[model samples]
Target: MAFVSSERIIPISDGNGLEGGGAFLPITPTPNDVWNGWAHSGAWIIQNGFNGGGKDNVTSAPSQAAQNSVTVSDPVTQHTAADPVDVYTGAFLYDGPGLKVGNGEAPMALDYRPHYSTNWRLQNTAKIGYGWTHSYDIYATERHASDVDIHTASVAEIAPYWVTAQYLLDTVTKIPTAKEVALRVIAARWATRQVLKAKVTVALGERRIEFHRLSDGSYMSPSRFRVALEKSPEGVFTASFKHGNSIEFGGPNAHASKIVDQYGNECTFAYADDGLASVTDAYNRTLTFGYTLGALSSVTDSTGRSVTYSRGSTFDMVDADGGVLSFEMDTYGHQEILSVRDGLDRVVVVNLYDVFHRVWAQQPLGDALKPTYFGYAPGLAHETDAWENPSWTKFDSRGRRVQTVDMLGNVATWV
Candidate 1:
């Protein structure tokens, strides 16, 4: 049975992505390269604009809100003086990359990509309303990246595609591959006793949702996702995501000798008498890593630029450009990252966090002020945003949206 993969992506870093109490990395666009992009978890979510033939563009799970285009006379703020704004409540989306099984037809649909590749950068923000979207399955292989459009195919395209139906059905993946995972989605709209239980599609009716790392293959960083590593019998430290791909670290060597990705790509490490000495990601690429006084002194990534870390308690980095990316930690309690500062230490990138470590509010990239506030649904967005979180423009467990409150406190509901 081909299980359906619901699409959702929450940060593996406390499932909220506000590590180091800040957001945005000026030095590197993709900061999750340290763990090879395992910083976020793919979630199972509702499908709102999908399953329709030609009403929408399911070919690409765009996060753009229809409200952005439509102007509204309704006031945004709760007060009477508030003027009407052009933006409307956005839609809820299962935003990310993903894979799908064949449609339930005879020559079942083959691998289908719901979005763009990992390299494509997109934003999934919430202003008023939200929408449903899909993302990469953690275990989806290259086999899932077919650009075939079954929803709006031309007669010519469908004729040729149907002609090869026998070949498609004969070569479909029937079981889990080592590098792939079944999409076990939080299938329901509301919270059950299991707290928004997740369900997987099965027997040729399912989709395969995958999770992708947020790295641009850059140097390592001090900020790390608070995930545990599984020690292998071979003494390797393995970190695998829920229903996504995995990366392995720390081999027989006292230190992690290698960092290997799911596709077998790896960066091998070597150490000196003092500490780490060298790292070779490929035959042609070698980097120098060193430690001083038992602490990481300097590291040079493939960019050939070295960033030095202070020996002090703060995890700060001084890039070659003279800019500093600093993380302030709490002295007491859990000692979480208090805030993140840039080289100037003037404009704040990330400011606050909720108990769940989600972004309570933060400035958008480039814009230093006027932070976008965020409030989460009770359970995981994957499991219950449809019903529990009215911010999303999707139907819930009750098959209806109870009510919606915008950033301005405007309220709307479906009765």
Candidate 2:
């Protein structure tokens, strides 16, 4: 295999994309150092709550990824008079946690967002929230135009982290007299999109503030994780996260009014006809921002220490103490890539995103540098990582791993 070596982005600015860890630090740290959108590539995951892909009684199509279901009468009422049970046949095959009936729940119908996070890591960015992760992961949920609130439907996270999918169903239990069984059954959708109800979203990002409404009419949120999204009297949407921070959006033009934390900290930015604005934190320390249109010019901390940026055909950054960080770009075929250099002008980070391999085929400029492939493919049962080294895995038709081979050719077989 042709392995490629590369570097990771070590934020040259005191902002969001502070990913690659090294001996990097800003002149100072504060709130203004948090949400610099332009600090990294525009292609990164935004995690802005929901991604807008919901379906009513969705089914899979691809050969190995298909979730084949039969619409036979629900076993509970298949032979009786009460409205048919809502459950289907194949659902039982997937009822267990981390259990697989096929290759994966990855390539799912509800996972229609065409983003790399979803495709690569199988992460459902559509929500930053969830209810009873395990109990709800594979479950179907729905609501109708005339319904009072959105309720769980059935199909059936945190239980099975690697697998994620959610489907909407029009099936509303009649609660009529029917045969009692060990499992709950939810019928498939029989209506079209015109009348299909919208799905309620959960705001469950990893350790991020989580919010979910429970059946008893109470919210299952963190100690102070009350309202993730709420509607105002003016019909505007306001999202509040943990720590009393709030994001207000949807004004006259649908633009997001800058975020404000609990202590009343705000981003102080300047347009062109003005001097740099000062951003004061809850601690009273302030940072000054200067920009030169389309580029961030400099940032000065309250201590009067500054980090400056200069860009021409290439980019360069200098810290308060004269430490230098430089960035350059190159094109291979048609793809343009970025490279970062440290104070010594030594290459520390390289940008090489390979679309087809589904990963970055290069390792960083760390002490131990080597060509490596950190990516996965739907057809390939195994993957490699910058840490795990080169490994091979054999998967069945359903996408479940059957065998694995490490770079040393060590064999591991899974039945």
Candidate 3:
């Protein structure tokens, strides 16, 4: 008889000394001959033709990468669909050649790769004159645009500015849906940047009005100034001017009322069902307003001064004194260009806008010729010729003109 083992098989011969002796042959197991069994602990037992039976532990073990699919609480609830919780796959650590010791601890590598992602990268290296420096760049995966290192500080030195910038970009600027963009545009149009807990000084002509914005979004302008504004809970606003003259504005559906002077001379207002009707001034003079086909047709002031408006592709307003102000509108019907003309139809003032729809220049009837240039930084207005002398107006982060520097380097600062 011949016996077969896992490593080798031996053949037996009977009476091999004879010339034609018969020998026993060895047989090997096939795939169908293998046995599959299970252990008491529920582990699978696999038997191979060459190696015999063994337990398969590789498939039974849990995978570390598979833990990424585990459920977890979302940190950012706003814009839930675009949450970045599951965006990262894994993290890795690396060290540089430089080594240093600190606090009696083991020597550690001086440089390290803290964190990185497919959408983010860190550059930390030592420079000759600048010393060691690091920068983190964040890329937009959807747009495939260039990366922006938002960690840089602004002139105001506000900390963590990148957080707000990223939030705005994710929520507003980078929104991919058209419906979301439309809704955001509408909301922004109606939103008011009300001054809350701020002190502001406004220069009008030759006077300066200092005002303080209250915490409740209300403003207080003291009696020292010529103008003041007060708001009511019902959305009504009352504007008081010098000499006890005041104007009160009602809600959107209500008309405005006014008091001319200290003697309590009242001016009552009336409005038509669709629009404005007429205003009777303190002197019992009525200023009438007329509309034709939902458009303003004429406006007559209390002093009997009237202006007639005609609307076509452009809007033209001709005053009773023969002065004309023609307005050119953009595609959205916004007044883009204004041309002021005298009775003779000669241009008096022409204001122009750049391609970006910003106020580029203002041309007034002048003897020397060129128009006045205007510049802007964010929300601050920079006009070099607005002051008494050639000067530059500087505004703080709150968009308040905080300082003014003249040509002679004389600076007038406001708190």
Q: Which candidate ranks first by TM-score, i.e. highest?
A: 3
- The local distance difference test score of each candidate is 0.32, 0.34, 0.37
TM-score to native of every candidate shown: 0.32, 0.38, 0.39
Residue 263's lDDT within candidate 2 is 63
Candidate with the larger TM-score of 2 and 3: 3
Ranking by lDDT: 3, 2, 1
**On residues 351-380, what C-alpha lDDT tens digit does candidate 1 reach at each position?**
343443333344433253444433333211
lDDT of 2 by residue, 1-415 (tens): 1222322222221122222222112222334322111111111221222122122222223333122322322122111000110011000000111111122121110111111111212233212111111211121122333332223221110211111112222222356335322111221132222123332233221123323333232333433335555546674545666567665553322323334667665432222343324433334454555657534466565666775667666556676678876655333432122455788878764544443322233336732345343323232322334454344444444344455445454555555
Candidate scoring better on TM-score of 1 and 3: 3
**What is the per-residue lDDT of model 3 for residues 1-415, given as tens digits with 9 covering 90 to 100?**
1222322322211111211112212233336432211100011123242245342222323335323332223222111001111111111111111111122111111111112111111221111001111110101011111222234322222222333445446676453588767765554432222212233433221123445554455555643355776657875656567656665655422334433456666755576753546655444556566677755466665455665667666556575666665444444433333444545656655544443344434556632245544433332333333232233444444344455444454445565
lDDT: which candidate is best? Answer: 3
Off by over 4 Å in 3: 1-253, 258-262, 301-305, 363-371, 378-391, 407-410
Worst 10 residues of 2 by lDDT: 85-94
